[model samples]
Target: MEKDAGMVLHTLFEQTARRVPTLPALQWKADSLTYEELDRVADAVSGWLSRKGVGRGSFVGVLQERGLEMVVAILGSLKAGAAYLPLLPSWPTEQRLEILDEAGCCCLILQSAFRCESASFTGAKLELDDCRALARVEPPPAERAEVLPMDLAYLIYTSGSTGKPKGVMMHHGGTAANISRNAHLSCEEGTRCSFSNSYTFDVHVADIFKPLSVGGVVIVTRDIFRIPPVDTLSTLPSRVTRARVPRALKRIIFTGEPPTQASIVRIPSTTRVLNIFGATEFFDATLKIIDVHGCPSKLQSIGKPLGDYVPLWVMDPDSKELLQSGAVGELVVGGLQVSRGYIKRPELTSYKFFQAPWLASEKQEGGRVYRTGDLVRLCQDEEYEYLGRVEQQLKLNGHRIDCATVENKLTSIEGVSEAVVVLRDGDLERGQLVLVAYVSPSSAAVSVSSFRDGLPAHMVPTRVVGIDTWPRTSSGK
Candidate 1:
């Protein structure tokens, strides 16, 4: 198989670094690193790793909190021709060990003072505090090792439906394609992004590398993504947020879940709110910008496919037949962004990634496709409306019910703040799945009986459990 003529990630970083040596590449609270300075530092990092026996195809584990040090570790690891496995300091020791063992990590990167509690891994350790010593060692050149575009750029582990975290391997080409597709992100043009999302999350993959790809700058704040939406907006500088005033931020890129009405109102109406939908297997499947600025896609829609790089297909889950517009089916994504596959899981990778049958009939092209397992429909305008997960569809009261419909209906009500519908043990005699809801302010003027005015009686929640907040993970599960 011939490799595509794609540029490696670190190679792209070098192009921008040379093009804009004086441009601010990264800015934290008080310190900012220019492109030249960052390149020098990354080179030093590469040399440090090289001396520690980290080379091409090596998986180096990174367990530092979000900071300038973490950035150095990532770029440096890539420059050294090794894939960086990012781990949060907050993750459980057991989980960290599992990832370490599963990926067969060759080394670990962390701050000098940082240490994982109850965690032990037999790998060479590199610390950020060694920058001074590394700088004195006459560091090796950035081009010393060859890391091809098809080589693994990073491995982001995400918890699957089975409640186990698995690493998703992303090659340089897929990541580079995403950055190139979103090249307009350059902070040089005054359009910048706040980098607060956890390094462990794939969303951070773009926030960290996209700017460097375009000689743009990214504001790095510690654990900014973990905080609430309101606080995250405050970290952006005036220059970045000046375009979209009254919101205190430039472009707010949100993923994982839809933003709540309460959160939306806080953002300035003019601020570009981009809703990104993606999985570990694919960097970005759809890019939907929600605003009244002549944007055609609805707020509920996931917008059109990202670019020519990634094509969309709504396929019948059972027959694998392609569906027409407005027909609900599984969302299949195929293109350069479709990943190589899951690491060390051939069965899962084969099941998830495959050549789509629709390619022969609809596209007239040949390529592997990742079955998203997300139920959606293509609108008349070619936009796709998200209908929740395929597993989200459950059987209740002998009706193939979609809980998303019920939850969406409830949230659509005027007074309700948020709503989550869960399945409980159904009635023994009726043999129907019971729907339980957990929402705040149960008496928020929502009539349980009147709520059923539009929804089927069976779709209504069998029980309403009031709560101040829903129990969720750090990712807002």
Candidate 2:
């Protein structure tokens, strides 16, 4: 790795902090934190980690909820020159421990309020009861450790088709690229950002960093599943008079699962919602500026790639040939946004991230791109409309089935809160392909019979399991 492959993720945070010391860097509930304060506090955190022997390249587990503690832990870990691994408090204890052990984390940062299986961790704990108090501390011995851009910034785990979770290594360089590429998403000084997603998912990266990258303040919402209405973006003093939203604070960005069509219209018309799409391999490569005034025809068609910095190519999955206009093929994301690869799984890493001569520009090196399993079409308007996952196309009992279509259609039913359809491999010798549907809020009136009526008979699930909730991955399911 080059000594300065790119700018370290926290360098920009420190730069902005120095320039605007008293500017509000974050907002949690009624309390607010200044840029200078956050930086000084993170310095203290880095020093604390140094005393505990954590430094560059070490993975530190952050088991705090989305609040002051969580934000501080992330910034502090970066300042300490360590990769911050976010462990969602809601995750099962066994899964958390497995990930903790897998990453070989130096220590776990937890809030006093979080009651996790601490005994199971059996590791160093930095439990802060009042994270805000640290902002007033005196400068420490090791304020911020030196780190290379290639060094890991955070580690995110994603569930694999093979029934195991795999860790993806996101470096400082990749993170910087992601933010810089999507600068159009209202990354200005004093922009209001919402950190809604769990830190466990990489989506949190944009929510937290996009605002901080531009000296804007992030409203650290405790709510995990939803972003607050635009009116609520104000601090105590600002909301008193609602003349108009400040020009700088006009944009809100989110990924993973998108909001419903009805929910999108409810947001303030002034707010420009940027729907960002990307694979875990890259933070966010495609960003679409959705005009809330003119609602989308359908909830999909997530616009284009982020400028020329990152290239989006639709390629034939089997032949790897670049598809022309309007062709539905596997989406390939390339450019500076691509992460280093999977943490320790070389085979899986090689399988996903490969050289893409098809997408190479004169300035590009080796033309690296990540093969996203998502099926999307290059539309007539020069945007991409997500169809469904390639995995949905399964041949069972001599009938071709598209489970992705069924799942998309099934979610539209009024009573169904959420649903998951998976094609299971059972007794493959007899060509037994079992499609299982898991519906949440078990009492949800949506039934197997409805799926059969709505979907092609062959595409219908063989069994339906009504669980209280679908087993959600850190990505908020």
Candidate 3:
């Protein structure tokens, strides 16, 4: 792999600026920012941030929906030599504040209308719209800004112990590496798109960054695209082709609540669907591109690693050893794709990232491999079939959830002492969960109805069953 990290990103942006400056880079409800417009806005924001004493090594928190503002904020952060932290609007203000504190964010950017709403960041907050309001102002001072390839580019806040949040620090080198390897996968020039996805989800990063990096235009819409539209279930294919999704534009990407058959049938014959599998720690690990006729287009398998930067492994889960050819095990990954560590959290990082002895035999040392927590069976053909996660984590309607996270909430119920939750397969259009709980007699007086009232709709198990005692392992004390 090349040592220079920012080369790919700088090159992509420069190419797009030169070729498609007037093409729509971002399109919202009524407002659209062409490549030239977006570039100017990003530069303006960069200049404004520089005047505010923000530059290389600075962390800037961005709180905005997926729209023109989000695009500008991300590119601006890159230009300003700082990492941009994206926070979801649905996130609780208290949780957002805690993340800001952990990241040591000096300046927070938000929409002007959002300022009227409640937020709890102790850092200096700047209105994104207001920055545009001051567009007429010129940059104050120009200073030399130097950014190391390994300098932190962004810090994403993920779930943590103590029910708080932990920040995952990403470096420019790693970010640029992933973008470089995947930009070619996006739609080419003149492609129109309905940019539908929550900005917080890591998968959306590919959707936003890659398209923009290329000369294609991304139509930014307020209405979330992942949610299935019942009205267009029968006609989605034609609409999709007109929308010009990425090369792999299968209707299945729009995972809805139950996964309706109508929605599945809507996949046009011309649409190409790509099944993506990976975690935040590992971006775009594997790709299985399916044809509109629903056949594997690439290698009849998830293709090989993207760049010279990644190494893959299949290990025996119970033995915690490398599985020979045709043996099934948990998939482990190591290489440039592996991030340095979580921000200010060494314990968690050590727990997930560990020494891979298999690398020793391969003559590759001095690297840590991430245990993906995935179970895969190596086929005789040398390809791997994904079995599923070894834990309670599952993708329901395209949302990641750990049964433990919800089970913990159930046990917190006044009457419940212990709880177990499982996903039930059915109604591919809507997802449902079953919750089994054990409660004390006195606590039993607290009705299941009342207990459910205290939980979020998603956490409230569809079926609630009361148990007399909780199951325990043989080694239980």
What does each candidate score in C-alpha RMSD?
Answer: 4.5, 6.1, 11.5
- A best-first ranking of the candidates according to their TM-score comes to 1, 2, 3
Q: Give model 3's TM-score versus the native structure.
A: 0.71
For residues 1-477, write the lDDT of model 1, one tens digit per residue: 014337677776788889889988777676778888888888888887888888888999988865667788888899888999998777778888889889999888877666555237788887675444565764766458888877898998887788778789988887786776665632433235567666777777777677777766777865443332221232221112112334555566667765444345456665667777887788777877767344222556888877766778888988888888889999998877777888899999988888776565554224688899899999887888988889988886578888777777776565565777888876778765688877655666655785778877778887777665455544535
| Cα displacement (Å) at residue 139, model 1 | 1.6
Any runs in candidate 2 off by more than 4 Å, and if so which? 1-5, 112-116, 119-124, 132-138, 224-252, 258-271, 291-298, 357-365, 407-471
Q: How accurate is candidate 2 locally (lDDT)?
A: 0.71
Tens digits of per-residue lDDT for model 2 on 118-176?
66676677886566565455345444588887788989898866768889998888677
lDDT, candidate 3, 1-477, per-residue tens = 465455534345646887888887776666777888777777777777887888888999898866677877877777778888888777767777777778888888887766755355556676776335445574522753566667776777655324456677766665566776665654556555545555554545566666677676666655333422211111111123223233344223321111112222436565544445555565666655445444211212454555557678888766768887666568887775566668888898887778776665553323678888776656765555654456755555566655644554554444444455666644556654344433322234444576566455655555555655444211110
What's model 3's overall lDDT?
A: 0.59
Lowest summed-lDDT stretch of 10 residues in model 2? 234-243
Please report the candidate that would top TM-score against the real structure: 1
Instruction: Please list the C-alpha lDDT of all candidates, in the order they appear.
Output: 0.72, 0.71, 0.59
Evaluated at residue 440, the lDDT of candidate 2 is 55
User: Rank order by lDDT, top first?
Assistant: 1, 2, 3
* Highest-lDDT candidate: 1
